[model samples]
Target: MPFSARLFCRPPRAARSRRSLSTRISAGVTALGLAAVTAPALVLLAPAPQAAALPNGLAATPPMGWNDWNSFGCNVTEQKVKSVADFMVTSGLAAAGYSYVDIDDCWMSGSRDSGGHLVPDPAKFPDGISGTAAYVHSKGLKLGIYESAGTKTCAGYPGSLGHEQADANSFASWGVDLLKYDNCNGDGTSPQQRDTTMRDALARTGRSILYSLCEWGQDNVWTWGAGVGNMWRTTGDINDSFGSMLSIFHANVQLAAYAGPGGWNDPDMLEVGNGGMSFTEDRSEFSLWAEMAAPLIAGNDLPGSSAATLSLLGNRDVIAVDQDSLGKQGTQISSAGGLDVLTKPLANGDRAVVLFNENAGAATISTTAAAVGLPASSGYTLNNLWSHVKTTSSGAISATVPGHGSVMYRVSTGSSTTTGTTHPLVGASSNRCLDAFNNQTAPGTKIEIWDCNGGANQQVTSTASGELRLYGGTQCLDATGGGTSTGTAVELWTCNGGANQQWRLNADGSVTGVQSGLCLDVTGGDQASGNVNGTALELWTCNGGANQQWRLG
Candidate 1:
C-alpha cells in the first residue's frame, strides 16, 4: 500500500466500559440500596500524562545503554543481559537515564510458536521476552528488541518482511518499549514500500514504541523519516576507529536540514567508552556528536566504564546541544583539509559551533561573523561547551584546533567591555581574503592583495546575501567571469552575485566557490610566506596545503 494511505490506519481504541444488566429483583434491591448509596459517593480516577510522548519523540535523550551487536554480537545471553542490567543500577547508569536494555540480532530461534508468534532463543533467553522485560523494568529500565524489514535480518534471523502487523502486535504484547527496525535484506529498489510496511506495522501496534529506522540514507530518509520513525540512521554502521567516526561525522552535514524536534538523524551509535580511540579523539567524537544533534546511544559496556568514560558521558553542557529543544542539526560552514567548522542554532537563540580537525597533522581553524553568515563588527559572547569557559569578543571568533580534535562553543549576542580596533587593510591579518591569486583582472592583470581600502579592487562578496563580503566596496572579488579549473584568474568583478563567485570560507580555512565547487589556489603554487604578487593564480585540489591556505584578517 502507499505510505500516505497506510498512515491513515490508526490503532483501534479499546472497548469502553459498559453498564451491567441486572435481574428484575436486582432493580428493586438497587432502589433500597440507592438510599444507602446516596449517603456517600466515591469515584476512582487514573492520572496519566498520556505516556509523556517520548522525549525528542523517542523514549529519552542521551539514549543511555548498550547494544550487544557491537561488542558481543550474537553471543549475547540471558545471563549477560541480567548482569548488565544489575550493573546498570549498581554502577549509576540507570540513574543517568540509560534505561533501555536492548538486545540486538541473534536472540531469535529458528522457529515460531504454534500460534505463529516469533519465539526467542530458549537457550539464550530461557524465561522468554516477557521475563526479560519484567527483569529490566524491575531495575527501573525498559527493554528493547531488534528486527529487520527484510526477509532475513543482518544476522540471518527471521524478519518482518510480510508480517508487519503481526510483528508489531507481537512486540506490543511483549512490552517492547524500543524497536531497532533495520534494513538488511529488503527490496532495495523500493524504499517507499519498505517505509510503508514498517510504518504501518508500528502505527497499528496500539502501543507507543520508540521506532529507530535503520535504512541508512538511500532514499532520502531524512525527508520522510519522521512519519515513519522517531529517528533514522543517517549513515551505515560506524566502526570503533577514528577514521570511521570522522567519515560518518563529516557526512551528516548535508542532512542537517532534516533533523529537528520529534525527529533526529542517527549517526549509528557512540563508540566511545569502548576502548577504541585515543582519549583526545574519543572526547572529540563525543563533543562532535552532541554538537551535531546525533543520538547518544552509548554502544559500550556502561557497567564497566572507566572514570574518563563517565566524565565524557556526563558533560552536561555538551549534552544540552543534543537535548536542545530546537533540535537543529549542525552543518559544515567551512572546511579545509581535515579541519571543518559546523554550526547549529540552539533553542536559546545561541548558536553552537564546533571546530573539528580530522587530519593527522595539527591545523588551525578559525571562523568570523561573516564566514558564519553573521554580521562583521558585531560583538558576541562565546561560551566553550567542552571547557565551560566564557570568551567575550567583538568583530570575530577564531580558534586553533588540534589534529583530530574539536572545540565547541555556544555563541550569543552580549556586551563585551573589551573592544579592539580591527585592522583596516589587513584583511589577511584578520584572516579574511578579498580575492584568489591570478584571478582574472582585465585579463593581463593578476589578482593581488591590496590594502583594505573598501575599493572596487579590494571588495569581495559572497553568493549568500549579506554574508561574507569584501571589507569595503559593494563589488565582490569573484572568479573571473565564473571561470573554472587551473589558471583561471580570480578578479575583483562586480557582485553579479553568481554562484560561481559565491564562496564559503570553511572552518578549516578552505574557500569554496559556490558555482564552480573548487578551492581558491594561490598563484605559482608558492607556499612560502610573503610570496610577491602578480603570480599566476588558479583553482586546485583542497589539501590544507600552505598555498591554498589563506588567512582572513
Candidate 2:
C-alpha cells in the first residue's frame, strides 16, 4: 500500500537510515553491590497516574482492528469484509481486542449521487455499507469506512471535501462506528483545517464515531491531533516488507511523547502474514508495534493466513503491552549494529523490554533491570511473550535474537523490601551533589549540580532496573526526547521506565545513560575545575572527564 500505480498528489516519503548506537548491560551488580544480597519482602508500588483521554470518549487505549487496504486494496467487497469479521471472532482476534472491520479507499463509487451523497458500488456492495455494518454489528464488532479530505480518494473514488456533512450523515446512518479520513486530492486549505472540518461533522451527527486522521504524518499532526481525532498517522503508508516496516518504525518511535490515551500516533497498519517478509520478521514487526503502543490494525488475508500468523496475532501478552493502562509508548534503550533494546513501563509498575536484532545473523543483546527502570530487588522475573518461557535473573536481561527477530519480556519482581538504596551523587571534581532545580519534582525540571545540602531531592537511587530516581524513587533523571546526540539535556520526570531514564555508574566513576551510551556530564565542566552550582546536566561523549565522574554512597 505504500505506493499506488494511479497515485494522487501525495508524494512518497524518502527512506531513512538507522541510527548507529550500541547497548551495554554494564557491570551494574558491582556498582550496586559487589556481594550477593538477600531478597527483600516484595511490595509493589501503586500504579502511576493514568493519562488524560480524549474528550470524545474513544480509544482510551490504542484501537486494534483490521483494515483491507494492505491486503485486498480496491478489491474490497461487502462479502470479504463480513467474512473477515467472522474470522476475527472465530480466530480469537475479537476476543483478543480486535473489533473494527475497516474497508479502506475504493469502497465508494467514482461519483456522488444527484443529492451529493456518496454512493457504494452496487456490484461490490449489493446491500450497501449499511448492510455490511449490520452484519458486523450482529457479530458484536464495529465497522470503519475510509474517505479522503480532498476531491478524490487515493483510488480515485469520490471524497468528502465539500460534502462532509452529507458523507458523515450517510456513514452515521450506515452504522459506521469509525471513519478513516485521509489526505489525497485536498483543497488548497491546510490539513489541520480540513481534518477538523470532518471531525466537527462527525460529532454533529450525534454518533460516537472514532475519527482517524490519515494525513501521512504531515503538518505535525501529532502535536494538535489529540484535539481533532482519535489517532493520527505519524508516517506514510506501510507495505509488507521489513525495510518498509523498519523505516516507518524509526519515523514513529521518536514521537512517543505525542501518543497516549484518547489519541495515538499511528504508524500505519500491520503487515503480518502478507508474505513479503519472513516469519521472524513478521513476529518482530508485531513485537515492535505493540512495544510502541501503536494501533494493531492487521492488514492481511484472514482466511488464507497461516496458523503461525494467527498465533502471533493472538499473543495476549504482547497485546496487553499494546493495551497497557498507562498508555506509555516504549522508547529505545539502546541500538547499534542492528541490536536494539526498548522498554515500556506498565501500569502495574513492571517494565516491558524488547531485545531486537536487525542484523543478518543471530546476535546477543543485553541490558540490566536498573537500566530498564525496575526497582532494585534481589531477583527479577522475565516472561518471554513469544516462547512463553519464564526465567529469573539477578538484574541482567539478555537474549540471542535471530536476524530480523526480537525477544520481548515482561520484567517484574516478586514483592521485595530491598527496593533500592538512596544516596547523593557527589561530583568527584566539584564535591557537589547532582540536584533537581529548586527541589521541584515536576517533569522537565532542570537537573543541575548543587552544593551538597543533604536535601531529599539530592538523594539519587540507582535501582536494580537501571533507573536513577530522585525524591524517594518518585522522579527519574531523563534524557530530553530520548535524544542520543551529544548535548541532550537531562531532566527530572515521572519514572515511566523509559530507556532515557536508565543510567549506569561505571567502575571508573563515569556515569553513562543506558539508552544513549553517552556520559552524564556537567555541561561545560569537562576540566578538573568543574562548573559552579546550578550548572545543568547533559549527555555528552564519554571522555573520562572530572565533571563526568561521580561518587555515590
Candidate 3:
C-alpha cells in the first residue's frame, strides 16, 4: 500500500542502520538483477477464502463516513471522536448518509499485555475502546478501527502482524463495524497475504465488519481487491493540495474496470475541510469522486467545520450518484481545451454525465447527447445535481463551468421522442416493415422489409453516436462492406464505432448516414408485401417517396 513512498520514511525500531550513497547504489544494482530474474514469474494470488464476501452483505454501495486520519491523526481520542459523532448528527451529515466514525492510529499502548492483547492507552481513552464504541453507536453511527498488517504501525505502535485473530476478535468484541487495515512494518507476508489474513480473521470472529484495504495502491490492488475487501485505496495518502487530489482522481478513474458492488477503488480520505484548496477545487474533488463511484469517507474535523465544508460534504444530489446501486463508475469520454466529459450508466437506462473544467478560469463546455452515449433520436430530461434544476434537452447540453468545477446531470433517455413514443420503422409504400433477415444476428445480414410483427428483431434503437442498432444487438445498420456506391445494400454488422454506422434521424423521417449523404430507401419503390421482402433495401436519392417514408418511434 504505502510501501513505495512511505516504506523507508523511518527506520525500523530495532533494525537501525545506514549506508553510504555508493553502497546504496551498489545494493540497488544487485537487487535489480535479482528482480529481473524473478519478476516474470510473479505469483498471481487470489483471496484466501474467508474474505471473499462481506459478513452480512454490507457496502452494497460505496461506504460513506468520516475518518480521523487526515484531521486528528495521532491526536485521536475518545472525547474527540465522540464530539465528531455529535457534529455528524447536528451538522446534517448523518442525515445525509454519513454513518461511520473511524479512529486512526496511536490509540493503543506501546506494549501489549502479558496475554499479548492490545491495550488501549489509558491516558487518552479512560473509558477504553469498547466504551468509545458504545458512545459512537449511541449517537446512531458505526465505529471503525484502524490496524496495520505489520509488526509495528507507522507510528511505532503495536500492529496486528502475528495477532490477526486476536485483533479481529477484539474488534468484534468492541463492536467494530468497519476495519481499515493498513500496510506498514511487514511481518514477512506479501501485502495480499497480509490483508487476506486479517479478512479471514474477521470472518472467524463472526462480525460483519466492512473491510477497507488501505495498502495504498501497492500490488495493483484493483486487480484483486474485490475478493479481499469492500474498498481499497488506489493511491497513497492524499495531502491538502490540488495536485494530490487531482493525481489521485486520475489514478483511480483509470482503474474503474476493476470496481463493482463488493469492491471500489478508494482515493483516500477527503481533504475538503483541511483548508488548503479553494471552494471550486473542493467542489470538484467531491463531485469527481462521486462521479467515479468512490467511497465517500470524510477525513476532516466536523466539529469545527465551516458551512461551506459541511455543504460540500453533505450534498445528497452528488452523493446519490455514488450510491446509485448500479455501481458503474464513470468513464472519460473526451478531453480537450482543459475540459473533460465523463459518463456513467445508471439503472433503467438513465445516464449521469459530468462536464469538468480545470482551466484557469470559467469556460463554456458543450457536449451532444451522442457524444456522451445517449440515443440520438430520443429526447432526454436533464437534472443538475448541484443546483437541483431540471430542464428538457433536445440533443445537446452546454454550461459554463468555473475552473476546477463541474456541471453534473442525470439524463433519462427516450422520454421525449416525437408523439411521445419509440417504435420500429414502417414503409409507407409497401406497408411492410424493415426487419433483420430471418431474425438472425450475424455479419452481412441484410435488412429487409416484412409485415409488421411487433417483434424485437424488427425494432431499431438510436445510439449515442447516431448509429441505429440492429435487433438490440451489437450489430449496427451498416453500408454493406463499407460501400459508398449508389446501390449498396443496407446490412447489419458488428458496430466498429465509426461514422459509417452513424445515422441522422431527420425531422422529415429520413434516416441518413452522417458520413454518406444517402437515404435509407425501399428498392425501386416496390409496393407489394411479397416484393418488399424479395427486393433489397438500398441507399438512394433523398426524395420524399412513399417507399422512403417510415415510422421511427
| lDDT values, one for every candidate | 0.62, 0.78, 0.73
Ranking by lDDT: 2, 3, 1
Best by lDDT: 2
* TM-score versus the correct structure, for each prediction: 0.62, 0.67, 0.67
Candidate 3 per-residue lDDT over residues 1-553, each given as its tens digit: 1222222211122221132222222222322222232222222323232234444587888899998867776777899999999999988899989999988888889889999999999988999999999999998999998888877776768889899999999999999999988776665456789999998999888889999997766666677788889998765567777766766666666666777787887877888867788666777888889999998999777887754466578778789898888888888777787688888888667788888887768788888888778776657777766544445678787777766777788877644433212357666455567888888898888788887788876877676567778666567888887776677789888889877787775433356767778888888763334244645788886654446545452
What is the TM-score (0 to 1) of candidate 3? 0.67
How far is 166's C-alpha from truth in model 1 (Å)? 1.8
Runs with alpha carbons beyond 4 Å of true place in candidate 2: 1-53, 415-553
Model 2 lDDT tens row, 157-274? 7778899999999999999999999876665677789998999999899999999998766666677888899998865557668887776776666667778899898888888888
Summarize candidate 1's per-residue lDDT along 1-553 as a digit string, tens digits.
1211111010012111121111112212322232122213101112112212223346334354667666667787887788888977886766755677888877888666777678899999998888888888888888888987766665566778787788889888888888888765554445557766766777677777788777655455566776667777765557778876776675565566666666677777788878778655777888888877777777777666654466567566777787787767777777767678888777777788888888877667778755654445457877666544355778466776657777777777774321122222122112223443333444334455543444444444333342233434444556776677766776655556576556655443456677676767665444334334434345665544334544333
> Which candidate order results from sorting by TM-score in descending order?
2, 3, 1
The clash count of every prediction, one per candidate, is: 22, 17, 5
Which segments of model 3 are wrong by more than 4 Å?
Answer: 1-56, 414-553
By summed lDDT, the worst window of 10 consecutive residues in model 3 runs over 8-17
